[model samples]
Target: MDLLRDVLKGQSAKVFFSVFMALIFANPALASGLASGTSELTAFKDWVWTLTGIFVFLFIIVQAVRAMMDQITWLEFALSIVKVVVVGGCITVVTWAMGVFGVAP
Candidate 1:
């Protein structure tokens, strides 16, 4: 907690980022621990897919409400649609690639 407080209240952002970068780059034990947890990580990947679907559903609902309330411009709505489509397409590609790689989803 003290370390976090010191980092947050530090005079320079550079100091904080440097410390963060150092920890991530210099941490071999952390990487090894994660590597050993690959089987457990598969469970979290399933949760990630569920959360992604929920996020897309919620985003569409919010956009629909905002549109009905006349809160968003047509251009913004169009852009939002494009962004959602792109994300969906990416997910589809990843799913396809996983199938091709014979990864059990």
Candidate 2:
């Protein structure tokens, strides 16, 4: 097509992102369309994320307090931080498992 030829020759691709084309692609076949009223969902997700950020700060403070109180060594507190990071990294494994079991479809 002329459009493809134009793109291959480094012409503008704005035609692909025109309003009408964007609306169609944004809806796709998903039940929750990207262009739909998804702000409510995003708000919920953002709140949960905000809570988790606060939790991480509390966790670090608690760990540092324990080190000061001699309940745990500073090295042990560092190891606990590393452990938390490893657990966070494990989410990729769970994601991979879910995909293998067709949860994404």
What would the TM-scores of all predictions be? Answer: 0.49, 0.49
TM accuracy, model 1: 0.49
lDDT of each: 0.79, 0.76
Q: In candidate 2, which residue ranges exceed 4 Å CA deviation?
A: 1-37, 92-105
Candidate 1 accuracy as lDDT: 0.79
Worst 10-residue lDDT window for candidate 2 reads 28-37
lDDT of 1 by residue, 1-104 (tens): 76667667874586678887898678664456766557557778889889988998898788878888899976787788799999889988998999999995
RMSD of 2: 15.0
Clash pairs, model 2 backbone? none
**Reference-based lDDT, residue 68, model 1:** 80
List of clashing residue pairs for candidate 1: none
